[model samples]
Target: MSVSPTSQGQAAIFIPTPNYLFSASVNLGTPLAPIPLLEGGQRIVEPITGGTIGGPGFQATIEGGLAAPIVLNSGDGTKTQLAFIYAYGHAQDGSPFYLEESGIGGGPAQTTRIIMNVGGKFQALQKMYILAQPKVNEAKTLASVECYSVPTPV
Candidate 1:
């Protein structure tokens, strides 16, 4: 008796790999004082005044943006949960790319950090395949970021 060669072969699996996208240096205006809520968390807003996003084959000028962040403290008051939604305008190749970012942060109140993911659509055709990858921006503040495109399953 003999076994088939196909039975012994392993299946091929495709996984995504991350590629560097762009680095953005954001300049944020003064944050509107936090508004405390009677029931819980506080609401904060910040303005994105100006910045630059650049990388190989692509670069953009950050025209404007806004961020609304909410912070909720645990009953014990030792830990906090943060959620934020931000949107920005990018001028690239004589067109506009509207980008939005959102994320959640949880940790000790004193050392909380945000790991944001970004997605956007362009008005004109461009190297969209690079943009389709999962883009992540991790930072304590929105001052600066290194963006990357990670692979995903189809």
Candidate 2:
């Protein structure tokens, strides 16, 4: 008789915890009307007016951006959201950064992937994988996203 170990199929470079990066509070403008697409898909485009972002050693103002989401029925009396967002911001010390994100979810716990190109002290984020949890208020006027840096094994 022999015993064999089973695997959960996770990658070898998987890191359980991620480092805290920053949190962004975004103010939104009124969204444009939803345009109907084929196969019951609806496209909604919104504008990001302004906001703020702060973290351990960085603070910045969110200048502007766009949010375009395509929604489709899930056939279970629910809908699914696929969001694509972009933001351009600058820090207090004149450092500029750009952020792009994509997520799929209709609930508050959205698992988002973030990519940021920043200068100044936060330049280390250039090679790191970023993940975020974003939450938007019911009024759709404000959004708060908590970002983290994922460290992988070499």
Cα RMSD, model 2: 5.2
Candidate 2: stretches off by over 4 Å:
1-13
**How does each model score on TM-score?**
0.63, 0.86
For model 2, residues 36-150, the per-residue Cα lDDT tens digits are 9977889999999999999973589999999887888877878878878999989877889898999888755678898888888778777788888888899999999999887
User: Candidate 1's residue-wise lDDT over 29-56, tens digit each?
Assistant: 7778889978778888878787787885
Pairs of residues clashing in candidate 1: none
Q: Looking at candidate 1, what is the lDDT of residue 5?
A: 39
Candidate 1: worst 10 consecutive residues by lDDT?
A: 108-117
- Name the candidate that leads on lDDT: 2
What lDDT is reached at residue 73 by model 2? 80
- Residue 88, model 2: lDDT of 91
Clash count per candidate: 0, 0
* Cα lDDT, all candidates: 0.55, 0.84
**Candidate number of the best TM-score:** 2
CA RMSD for every model?
7.9, 5.2
